[model samples]
Structure formats: C-alpha cells, structure tokens
Target: MTQRSITVLPGDGIGPSIVAAAIKILDAAGCQFQYDYADAGLSALEKYGELLPQTTLDLIAKNKVALKGPLTTPIGGGFTSINVTLRKHFNLYANLRPVVSFAGTQSRFENIDIITIRENTEGMYSGAGQTRALDNSSAEAMSIITHEGAERISEFAYQLAVKEGRKKVTIVHKANILKSTSGLFLEVAREVALRYPQIETNEMIVDAVCMNLVMYPERFDIIVTTNLFGDIISDLCAGLIGGLGMAPGANIGKEVAIFEAVHGSAPDIAGQNIANPCSVILAAIQLLEHLNMQDQAELIRAAIKKTLAQGKTITQDLSGSASTTEFTDAIIANL
Candidate 1:
C-alpha cells in the first residue's frame, strides 16, 4: 500500500502541543503516512508576514489532505481567517462536525450524538461587503446565501447521512426573517430531500432548534444547516458532551479534505503542557476514516476511549493530574 502524505499545520500555542501528541499516537499505531509541515494563522503572520502563505496553500493542493491543529483567528484584524482561506481556495464546501457523549464523562446529557454538516465555503464568514452608515455610528455587513451553495451542502449532508446509516436528517434555517437568503436554503433542502425517501427529513428554524436541542437533544440525528447556524449548533452540541476540548471537525470537498480540532488556540496554557490532545487525535482518526482506513480509525478511537476510561491519566479539563505528554503516552502505550 502506498503511504498517504498529509500537510500538517500545528498552528499556534497549544496547537503544536496537541498535534505533537496526535503524531505520537499515529506513530504508535504504525499508520503509514508522510507529513509535511505548513504555516498559517498567527504563526504564519509572525514568521512569513502572511496569514495564509501561498507555500502552504501549494502544499495542500498537492497533498489533498491535511491535519490541522487549532488556529488563532485574530480579533478585529487585517488578516483573513486561515480556515476560511483554505476552505474557499480548495472548494471544501462541507464542514462536518460530529459530537458524541463518551462513556465515563460527567456530562449533563446522555446518549447525545449529533453530526452538524455546515456550508464551509460561504455566508457571512466569507468576509462579504461592509460599509459605514451616514451617521458613522452604524455599520452594515452583508450575508449572502446562494442556491448553488445551499444545494451542494444540503445534498452532501443527506448523502452523508444515508451512507452513515442515519435515518433522519434535519435541515435548519432562518427563512422566516431572512426570507431571501435562508429561504433559498430552505428551498434547496426541500429539493434535495426528495431523492432519499428511506431517510426521513425535517426543517426547523434555527432559534426553535436551539431551544429543542437544550430540552431534548436526543431527538436530533444529523443536522444540515448553513454556514453560521451550523457553526453555532456544532459548538452547542460539543458543550453538551464536554466542550470544544473534545470536538473534532473535518472540511471535505470533491478533491481535498482537512481534519481539524474544533477548538481555539489557548495561548494562556500554551507551554504549560496541560492542553488536551484527544480532539486532534480523534481528528486524525476522522482523517483515517476518510481515507478508508476504518480498522485503524477504530483502533485509535478504542485506544482513546480506553485511555479516558482509565480515568487516571487525564488532563486537567477532564479532572486528572496528567500533563499533555503523559496523557498522550498513556494512549500510545495502550495502543
């Protein structure tokens, strides 16, 4: 078998620590992969004076697969988002985030499993047009949602649900008010849902869905929504289980896919060596599953679950004394 090559962006702060741990686990599993490092986000801005360097983009284009750690998006910034740039450049239109409550965790909700399929390439996150009002006290920002974008992401969601053996897929929208943009999304979703009769589907407004999620999260199976709603729901589902510390995400398209941890770079705990790496490790497992290495993916997942189940070698967030490396070592040893 030919070893797959992947671009690795251990972005910033705790990003490097987590990626290092994931690499350790990957090596221990004997997974055959060649890695090339790239730079983006704050790290790239500091080293290369460019947030999303062309060199990094070139590498990803050639490799077509990447494993990225959490990247810090500067607030009120001149820099474009590293994630947004990559997604737009590669046409990675589907942002898939799966959230599940693992056993032995102290979560308020149980048996909670939801997959959020987000439109990765467009929406307000696209950095659309903005202008100042005549008063200069008010500003306006545009949010564009096209039928082409809506159709592709919705179809991708339904198809993924079918392949994964999921029976119901929920489409979320805000068409009641943003009747033009979100209405187009709702129209596309309704059009796409007709093809898969075996899989039941429903549409819900974003606000009502949020309320329902908190009240009865188990009712949801697979959720398909626009860029912004999907982003919010995915994070909420993560919090139901634990937090972003354990959430993993993937950006997939026709040609390329990038698996990433769905958390931010915690600069405060950067060198403290206490950040959890399971999210990134699980993201690698996602990458493996994407590559059709299901057996290896299961092995890595089992090792992680077993390590967490041990309950002795957990990071501070999980309420144990183990440092980042120690926790990773535990998982590697178990594997």
Candidate 2:
C-alpha cells in the first residue's frame, strides 16, 4: 500500500501529550502513513513570532490532511483564532461533529448518537464585519449569509445524511426574528431537502432546538444549522454524552480536511499527565475514516469502546484516577 503523508500540529498546553498518545494509538492500530509535524498557536507564536507560520500553512497545503490539537488564542490581543485562520485559508466550509454515548462515562444519557453538520465558513461566527463607536458605547458585527454558502452547506448535510443512513435531519434556524440571514438559510435548506425524499426532514427554531435537545435528544438524529448555532448546539450535544473531551470535529473542504479535538487546551494541566486523551484519539479515528481506511477506524473505535466499557483505566475527567498514559495504554492493549 502506498503511504499517505499527514500534517500533524501538536498545538499548545496539553495538546502535545494527547496528540502523541493519538499517534501511538494509530500506529498500534496498524495505520500506515507518514506524519509531517508542524507548529501553530501559542507555541508557534513564541517560536516564529506568528500564531500560524507560513511553514505550517505550506505543510498543511502540501499534505492536504491535518490532525490538529486544541490551540489557545491569546485573549485581548490583536490576534485572530488560529483554527479560524486555517479554516478560512483552506475554505473548509463544512464542520462535522458527532457525539455518541460510551459506557462508564459520567453521562446523563445512553445510546445517544447525533451528528451536527455546521456551516463552518459563514454566518455570524465568520467574524466578517465589525464596527465600534468612537465613544465606546455601541458596536456591531455583520452576519453575512450567501445563497451559495447556504445551498452548498445544505446539500452537504443532506448528502451526509443519505450516506450515513441517517433517518432524519433537523434544520435549526432563527427565521422568525432574524428573517433575513436565518430565513435565507432555512429557505435554502428546505430547497435542498427536497432533493432527498428518502430521508426525513424537520425544521425547528434555534431556541426550540436547544430545549428539545435537552428534553428529547433522541428525537434528533442529524442536525444542520448555521455556524454560530451549530457551534453552541454541538457543544450541547457533547454535554449529552460526556463533555468536550469526548468530542472530535472535522473541518472539510473540497481539497483539504482537518480533524481536531473540539475541546480547549487545558493550560493548567499541561504536563500533569492527567488530561484525557480520548478527544484526540477519537479525532484520529475521524482522520482514518476521512482517508477511507474504515477497517482501521473501526478497529480503533472498537478498542476505545471496549476500554471505556471496562472502566479500568479512564482519565480523571471520566471520573477515574488513571493518568492519560495509562488510559491510552489500556486502549492500545485492547486494540
């Protein structure tokens, strides 16, 4: 088999350790690939005087796939988000976040499986236009939504639903109040939903979706929404199973795709060896699936599920005392 090269960003705080654990697990699962390492985030800022260096960008462009750890964007600086920068640069317009229940985790629900398809490159979250009053009293930011952006993202969501054999897709929007932007999204999504008659389609307001997600999460199989709502709803779905530590996200475009742990870098626990590595490990599974290596992805996922079910070597966040390395070793042993 030919080897594929993947760009690996070890990010900041606990990112390095967790990403290393993921790499170890991928190797154990018998994935054959060459990894090209690069730096980004605070580490890159310190080393190269920039949050995202040109070398890192070039490597990502060359490799076409990246497994990134959580990056910390310095607050109150003239700095932009590294993740946003990468996504915009690559035109990664679709964000896929799936969460499922794992036994032995401190979760309130069971058998929960939901995929949140987010419009990654547009809407209010895009940071498009911003203006502040000279007297520091009023501020405004534009929420831009294009017909092309809405249509493509809607198509992507329905296509994914069909591919995954998902039963229903709930289109979440705030069309009642924000009738211009969100209304456009709802209009486009409805038009796209007509193309897929086999799959069921439901429309819900953004706020109502939140209430129903907490009340009747099982009613939702797939959720497609604008960028800002998707971001918040995905995190809420994460809470349904466990936490952000159990969530993995994929930013995908036509050419390049990047998988990452959806959680933030825990700077307080940087080298403590107690941070959970499941986020990055799950992200590696996404990476494998993206590469069309389904067998390896399933093998690793089964190992993780078995280990988590056994509940012997889970990390602190999972209400266990085992260190990150111990938990990772347990998963590898299961593999």
Please report the candidate that would top lDDT against the real structure: 2
Measured against the true structure, the TM-scores of the candidates, in listed sequence, are 0.96, 0.97
- Could you give candidate 1's per-residue lDDT for residues 1-335 as a string of tens digits? 87789899998889999998998888889887899999988888899888888999989889999999878878665545677878888999999999888765567888888999999877777754243345848666667788899999989988888899998999999999989988999998999999889999989999999999999998899999988898888888888887777899999999999999888898888889999898899899999998888888888899888888888888888777899999999988888
**36: Cα error in model 1, Å:** 0.5
Error of 1 at 308 (Å): 1.5
- Candidate 1: C-alpha lDDT: 0.87
Cα RMSDs, all models: 1.5, 1.2
User: What does the lDDT read for residue 121 in candidate 1?
Assistant: 77
Error of 1 at 156 (Å): 0.7
Error of 2 at 286 (Å): 0.8
Off by over 4 Å in 1: 128-135
Writing each residue's lDDT as its tens digit, candidate 2 over 1-71 gives 77899999999999999999999999999897799999999999899999999999999999999999899
